[model samples]
Target: MRCHKLVAYSVSAAAMVTLVAAGDAWEIKSQNKLVKHCANREGYDVCNIVLDISDTHALCSVCRLNRTIPDLAKPENRLRWSKLEQAKRRLLIGLMDLHLPLEAPVRGYSRGLCFDFLEDQRSNSDVAQKFITTGHRDGVITINILEADDVQRVWQREHVGERYRTLLGHMRHEVGHYYFELIVSDREGFGQIFGDVDTAYEKALKNYYARGPLPGWEQSHISAYASAHPAEDWAECFAHYLHMADTLETATAHRLIEQFSEQGDFEQLLLLWDRFSASLNEVNRSLGLSDAYPFVITPIVKNKLRFIHSAIARYVGLQL
Candidate 1:
């Protein structure tokens, strides 16, 4: 995951027209014999399956959120964009399953979302003259195209000392920041639960990089990066909450576990997650890969996740 520095800016009103037109191209259509079947590319068939089932002439809802895709004139950019879209669809599907809102800012919803898949000089110097960092601002999330490359992502993981990192993880983490603005920033007692987000962000970030996390930071923070700022702590915890929710949902869908209700008791969800994550790790080991989830959830972290669940339940009108 890249460093997230919140920038204050609203979506341009003028862009709404173009975004709406793009979204309309993906509307579900009745299957008909006249419809031309789309071909799946490189075994990445989520978008193709969506088109096939719906008989739509455009990409899926998740793919339609792409306001800006990387330049496809470059051969490698197409594959990278494809990989990014796959991870993005997974995130969107999970959000939908959880009954969270999926409106785009262009759709007249204040909390609407969009994506900008960009590349920096590191990936294509001829096309990108400036650096591109992954972050979320207003309603738009930006992801660096290099993250889609397995070799580049692995190098970043080692350089950052992260036990696990993936393009999906990046999306989940950045969206956490966006939701904090929508769900928590204005709520009463927000500071009390997640600390003060109104603190000087740039200075805090500078200091965090200068001296690193405080001693025994893991006792309270979910990750070393989370200790950098209160906002980061909330985002990291929120990301972890999504990790658990989506993975549990996938496991249930695959019948690896009996059907379980996410809207049920929060404690029960955590218990199931404890068992499921352990099994997931064992499965990864059997395949000679690292643990699927590499961080321990201390008691404090659990409390943070519960807070997230409560917030999400509130947003979705659930009793959990």
Candidate 2:
């Protein structure tokens, strides 16, 4: 997996982590006798801890390859890093749930998904730098640590006018980029559906960034970010599909939604998704919020999502 070139460091020396079980909490076993606990936020799972308190930010199995960590010496920064870590774990869990292939291009090339959580000068008043980039590449995903701060995230959210924004959302979006490589680079049937992805991705991306998206992009693209590149378009759509499917599955599991056809085939899933999404939008309106799944399904996009479903089914050897 190709790694990002940038690195993160703390403004102050590291502080030892201390563990305590305050009450009913989710915990996971670590290499040592110590137990790591979940931060207990929505969309997070227990398996995502980077270290037990006794270990003082020691890397967990999943966090071991991290070349750097954002400096957390500032009192406020420490709280931000903790929140970011939880969100990162939740995002990773969602990817694992999708059963996408993982592994670095050169190292665990066979299978493994990896990430780098970083902080740049933009977020730390003590740091001398002025900018940070947030995106994904190769096998590794890099997130600017500033995103962990609510004020920064909220500012960006409003500036972008995005309906939904969360750490998990960013993770999902980046994973969309990763799967582009997995499905577009290797899957034969996928090429037929998504088109010849070999069409000079770099040139297309440059054009997208320079000229801006095509007019009437809202008619098809799920988000403005999708307009940045074809691969980004694919990733944004893929992430939206997962968001819909997973949330709908949870609703069905809890009897909030009727069970989808037992065949659970892709077509059946679409049928269920459509009805559920409509209801979801209605519920959001009741709360004075925007639609939960906010995009129309053109026949073209439907075909693309079907290809995504089909590819996943084949990888898991599930009949569809």
Candidate 3:
């Protein structure tokens, strides 16, 4: 579905006060507000508010989807969970901005989404699990809490030979898998764009690990990992699409672009992204940091991303 452009809201203190009539409305307030406030786990003041409901301390919609969180008895786990929540919230914000459905799995919808934030033995020796791979199954996305640790994530990124790795990237990529089941699994022509998913996943992954990505993989895939299988390709492409859409929306909101419309000319958006991403990389380089986005969009990858856009358009009931 075509994403709706967010309407800017200008809320002055007076306007806020007016909306808080009878204290029945939600009002963005300072964290220091000792009365009562529903603050998002992510440190976003915009999402922090004073709810007028009886259960004013209730978790926000995004936080409520977390099926399990790491044990808080361990002080470090709290910080790790917070980092994961920050990334998850960003992913949810992107989906919500696009007007996509986001029901919890407990709602009984087959496509309902949920998350399990866990820590493996690597992070918590008390855990029985020796390892936990970040993945999606059914409607649940399991993320290893260790991904939130900067040193650990960088070490793993280097070990896996990844140009970029991040908790947000992991969340985006896994949600891509979840949406594949939601939007593309039973759709016609899915195979034509992403190739046959009927291929045995275990065998394909084993072979991919043995051989790595094919030589000249960039000509067709967005990342070497995307060449692992048809499903992986689709998920990777979908992740990139989310990255582009969210980044562009943020840039537009910051007035980096004069105007932006997700449903506007697709090619035009790509062109604008090319210029913006290049400048973004240059800015990062100026700071002696790695490129924010390390992959190039070849024609084949662009087609895959276009397919993702079309699927999202259909999912949101947008007439494209």
Candidate 4:
């Protein structure tokens, strides 16, 4: 939120941050209320939980979107919040690096973005809700804080028979849905490319859980859960697209495939990703860990990724 400079003190940190309020856009306005600089700011020690950029700005762009944070009184919640913030920072960094439309609605974005890190009864016995499904809706992303714990996340991943699951993966997946609503939802060729998102998702979800994904799902979809709905397919592809972009940036920064690093060249990225991911998997195998990237990107799934690449490029006015 834009505000004139003002002083605010941190109770937990026992420190005073100088006058804060500046040009960087992101207001802490929840759906039900406007909460300007109103967070306990309990997430990561380095997540800039208060988003103290300078005397002029109070929050980092990513931390500014937080609508609800877990109870900081609990030492466990503090650690969990830290992990969630790390994943979220990486996710937003990719979005910013890709030049995605990420401004809050107050800054003229079509929708306002916010995050809610909550605890449900399943995870927190005293919480009101029984279960909290991590998802995005109306620009609000709700993440069940339980995902921050490795044992719980891995248990659910195995129970669901998933090849991969991580806090970062969850962030990437849910943010994909947020972008779909903004850039691709009403665009031409989306239906022809991904499929109709207007189908009955609830029914489709029930059927998907009951009978599993379409036979030979990996022949086309990036992940089996993508077969549950058109939105899921698009979201899955979007997540993979982000995976490519972020990984390429990291690989290039480390001078691995530095020669192949070229922004806006989608084909080149795919080629480089294939070479790098294979080596990455091999490196993991050398260490007795699972393959770093498990799923194969079939020709059809590759096209889906290509579409995502093109769509994002078009969104940012980058050709090819």
The lDDT for every candidate, in the order shown, is: 0.73, 0.62, 0.75, 0.76
lDDT of 4 at 189: 76
Error of 4 at 185 (Å): 6.3
- Rank candidates, TM-score, best first: 3, 4, 1, 2
Backbone collision tally, model 2: 8
TM-score of each: 0.81, 0.71, 0.84, 0.82
Better of 1 and 2 by TM-score: 1
All candidates in order of lDDT, best leading:
4, 3, 1, 2
Superposed on all Cα atoms, the candidates' RMSDs to the truth, in angstroms, are 9.7, 9.7, 6.5, 8.8
lDDT of 1 by residue, 1-320 (tens): 15442111111111111111123233222222122123432134424333333444445445567789888788888789888877886787677767766674422246578999988788887864588889988778999999999998999989877777899989999988877765652455667666788889999999988898867978888888888888888888888988888888878878998866767779989999999999989999999998999889989888888888888777768423
Q: What is the lDDT of residue 203 in candidate 4?
A: 98
Error of 4 at 106 (Å): 9.2
Clashes of each: 0, 8, 2, 5
Over 4 Å off, model 2: 1-67, 101-111, 125-129, 185-192, 201-203, 260-263, 318-320
The candidate, 2 or 4, that scores higher on lDDT is: 4
**What CA RMSD would candidate 2 show?**
9.7
The lDDT, on a scale of 0 to 1, for candidate 3 is 0.75
